[model samples]
Target: MKKVNFRNKDMAWDISALILYPPGFNEASQYPTIVSVHPFGSCKEQTSSATYGKALAEAGFVVIAYDASFQGESGGEPRYIEDPSQRVEDISRVIDYAVTLPYVDADRIAGIGICGGGGYIFSAALTEKRLKAVVGITPVNLGRLFREGFSQYNPVAALEAMAAQRTIEARGGEMQVNELLPATPQVATENGLTERDVFEATDYYKTPRGQQPGGATRMLFSHAQKTLSWDAFAYAETLMTQPVMAVVGQKIGAFGGYRDGHEIYGRSIASKDRQLVELEEWSHYDLYDKAQPVSAAMEQIVPFFNKHLS
Candidate 1:
């Protein structure tokens, strides 16, 4: 296990990451590498990302997991400021750094993105041609989700409010906005949230289940406006040219991107190698190493990379 901190020229942030290869990794053994992008608010040490990276490392591939700009150990001003454009660039930069390592096989590089990272990697796949394969584990397509949320209110009003909020922040006012993720979950009701979305999210954040050092309980409010319209699905054609694997858990929540991406991707003749693996009785957070789903997903994930990487 080797930790490397590199500066991302595109986003102008000092990106922190770890590159884990098998114990005896050396110049003699050239191995495939997987660049993993974490969920929106998570860092490299978060359980799912760390476990997934280590799993790949143990299986003979070097795994690179890094914090996106403005999150985790990565550097950025006004912490938790979300930028879809910069995030995509950061993914590409990670790949750029990975390919330079002596132990890495540049041609066999792949990417795995979890949760919000699902969509981020999709965006990266479009322009980063060096990536031979991509995996989205319970991905959240920010574009569609944001569109759905924005539909409830007038888009004009929402944009106006965002602009006003930015104005305040620009004037050095304290950044005040709701960053939602409950530390403790309450019982679910007839409200829009299902048991899994509300309770499961709480369980991951509240308990020691998947906590990372210095992890935030609340996020930047302005980030909500930033993530709403960041749609990566429109670039399916570019992404589909490379092999893609999507994993979703049936029990947790229905991730629309996998279904939606499949719908768009299946219609193409060129997108032949794309595959979707639906894990039964699994929740979104369950993919984050919550026993039942993690083991099964890992079974599929390891083999998928092994088969494609070589």
Candidate 2:
């Protein structure tokens, strides 16, 4: 593993990333590469990116896991804001940096993203043709989540509240933020977040298990406005012509269904090769770090990229 930094020209931020090289990697030879995007409000060191980076590197692919511009070690103002547009552009910027590396095979570059990062990767892949293949692990469509609520149960009130918050922020009120996870496991359970997936996510992201210094659970209120307008699957049918795969857990507790992943795959009508892999008995957060599910996900991921990028 090696740390690197690059300037995001479009966003004017310095992006920090870690590149993992396959064993016996030689700079003299070009190798297939994969860009692993981190989840929303997470950093390079978080579970998903790091896990996939190491696992994929061991499988003979150069994997680059990066911090989003405003979130982790990257440079950006009003920190911790989750802007979907900027997140999508970050993948392209990383690809820009990747193509310059001596050991990177430009033609074989692909992308993999977990959770919210998966949504951004799909959005990026819509127009970023350089990404020959894309993989999404238990992907969440942030736009849908923001506009329709996590459970898709009661979004009308949530949308109204978000709009009101946007108005307040636009009028010079202090920036409001919301916690992405419960403050404590006790609180999570008190709020009926006892489902295995939700409980595990709280444990992993909020507690010592997977917590990093910059990996906060709070995000700007304005994120709702941006996310509400952004659709991850916009123009996917025609624009997403690249081979794509969305690996979702069969029992995704947080979202309650695999509708988002299925929508992404189904909308990619122009993709000659597309797949939706559902892991039995796994939940949304299970794919984040649970050894068995992570390994199982990679089993599908490695071969998909290998076949497509070959």
Top-lDDT candidate index: 2
lDDT per residue as tens, model 1, 123-155 = 787778788888888887766655664334465
> Where in model 2 is the C-alpha error above 4 Å?
150-173
lDDT of each: 0.72, 0.85
For TM-score, the strongest prediction is: 2
State the TM-score for model 2. Answer: 0.92
Q: Between which residue pairs do clashes occur in model 1?
A: 252-283
Candidate 2 lDDT over 13-109, as tens digits, reads 7999999999999999999999999887788998645689899999999999999877888988888888899899889899999999999999999
The list of candidate 1 runs beyond 4 A from truth reads 8-11, 150-156, 186-194, 223-226, 252-269
Provide backbone clash counts, one per model.
Answer: 1, 0
